[model samples]
Target: MSTPTVVLVHGAFADASSFRALIPELLADGIPVVAPAVPNRSLNGDAAYIASVVRQIEGDVVLVGHSYGGAVITVAGVEDNVRALVYLAGYALQEGESLGELQGGFPDSALATALVQTTYPLPDGSTGTDVSVDPTKVHDVFAQDVDPEITKVLAVSQRPLAAAAFGEPASAAAWKTKPSWGVVSSSDNTINPDVERHGYQRAGAKIVEIDSSHLVMLSHPKESADVVREAIRATDR
Candidate 1:
């Protein structure tokens, strides 16, 4: 059989660069990978954008999303070249569910307050703000397994999600029909592990628990990639 293509979707507060560490490993194994930059400000536009990318792909694809990107690909990538999905410390939404509703499902945590920022309106009627995480907190909240220098860069490089994106509901739940795989960051503070567990339950996705933080792909790239490869292999059987 030909190699499976992997289209990665990053979560809120991040872009396609979030998959930097994992893509190389997967590519080395002869698996093609694509991670489009998501428009963190416009959820609907972002989903439509990603959907276009999925539609352009040439072969059987495994759609992977991290955090809010999980929700985006669910709505955009469901009926494309995508044959399976991998949620890497990501969200899973059912039909009619929005990211904002999922956020409200659990009580606030340290990460919730950390996400707040001052928003300024733009000439285009959109808004913008800074998304900088404290360097020290990066290790505790994200990839603890990776190099300290990596988190140092990540702390400064974090992207902020637009307030409007969270309110966009899922166009449809991809998990309901697609075979899915989920990687849980047991120590994640950003998206409550409780919330992640809830997503896993809702999707009925095959589960793999990693004792890491929110950025499991960066912290545990090999393991993260392994589970994803396994997910693709499962489809071949």
Candidate 2:
């Protein structure tokens, strides 16, 4: 089989640019990659968008998702052409599982305390809550290992996730059928590392532990990219 185009999905409080450093490494090896901006609105809603992206691709696809992006691919990867999944400190929620349910089972991380919610206008004339890491706490709780200069920018510029997404159950769990790989950021102060471990273990994903913060791609791009490449190689049949 031909080398599959790698589709990257970023999680909450992040956008496609989060993969900035990693993309070059993959492209350097002649790898075709696409990192799409997710809406950070709702789980199923985001999944549908990503699924459409995958269906339009020319060849096979390896879906790589980080953080909440993991949950997005968990549903989007149900597309026929997605052959593998690479999870980067991502939520590998099961079908019928919600992020709140999975994370609530484990002890709270610094992120729980660091998050701040604000209201946004809704189409129906009601207000909805958007969740984001407190700008002052983002660097410490979300990406301590990342460069302060970068984290400072990320703190204020981070995308806010719709709070509703935390309760929405995933409609599909792609890792159940697709070959999957995972990276656990042992130093993560956002989602508890144990949550990452349990999610991957339940999905039967090949797993590795990286001693980095939630933003593993920034602090350990080579290692994170290595795991992604492994999934690509294993599924390129």
Candidate 3:
């Protein structure tokens, strides 16, 4: 096997730019990286979009997902060419499990109080819910380790996720069949750290813990990149 290309998937409240810092680091290590902008409107739709992106890549892929993106890749990473899956403070959900269900057992996330919900028209002409973290709480709950200045900008530009995305049950669990790795953000307030550990442990992933917030890729890009590289090496063998 040869070095696999990396396809990064960002979770709710974020876009492809969320992986900006980690991309260059992966590229520096000679790994090709692609961070596709996830629509985040629906779980199956997002996974299908990512699967299409994976199909366009030239070789095997190491699919990496953050936050809700973990659920996206858990569905998309089952693509034939995907050799590994890496979850960064991400949800590694089981088949038929929804993010909402998995989160039910965890301690209340700070994001609950910080979220702002708005109604929007869906393609079907029905009203849908879109959720985003309150700007004032973005830095504290989502990216505490990052500099407040940058987080301030992130808060304003943050993408909103459709509330339905969380309730959508995952149709696949890629970790069940693929090699897996995980980065547990020890200080994560958005997703309880214990929840992350349980997800990884259940998947039997090689786990690495970092003393960072939910935005580990931003707060600790080097470490995040290193973990991706480790997955590449493990799969390339």
Q: By TM-score, who's the top model here?
A: 2
For model 1, the local distance difference test gives 0.80
Sorting all predicted structures by TM-score, with the top scorer first, yields 2, 3, 1
Report lDDT (Cα) of residue 17, candidate 1. 83
Best lDDT goes to which candidate? 2
Clashing pairs in 1: 67-90
lDDT of 2 by residue, 15-92 (tens): 988999999999998889999989999999999999999999998999999999999999999999999999999999
- Which residue pairs show backbone clashes in model 2? none
Order by lDDT, highest first: 2, 3, 1
Q: Write the per-residue lDDT of candidate 1 for residues 107-161, one digit (tens) a residue.
A: 7645755654657687899766634445567666666666888777777776777
lDDT of each: 0.80, 0.94, 0.93
lDDT of 2 at 152: 89
**Compared with the true structure, what per-residue lDDT tens digits does model 3 show for residues 79-163?**
9999999999999999999998898987788888999999999789989999999999999999998989989999999889999
Model 3: residues with Cα > 4 Å off, grouped in runs: none
Question: If scored against the real structure, what TM-score would every candidate get?
Answer: 0.91, 0.99, 0.98
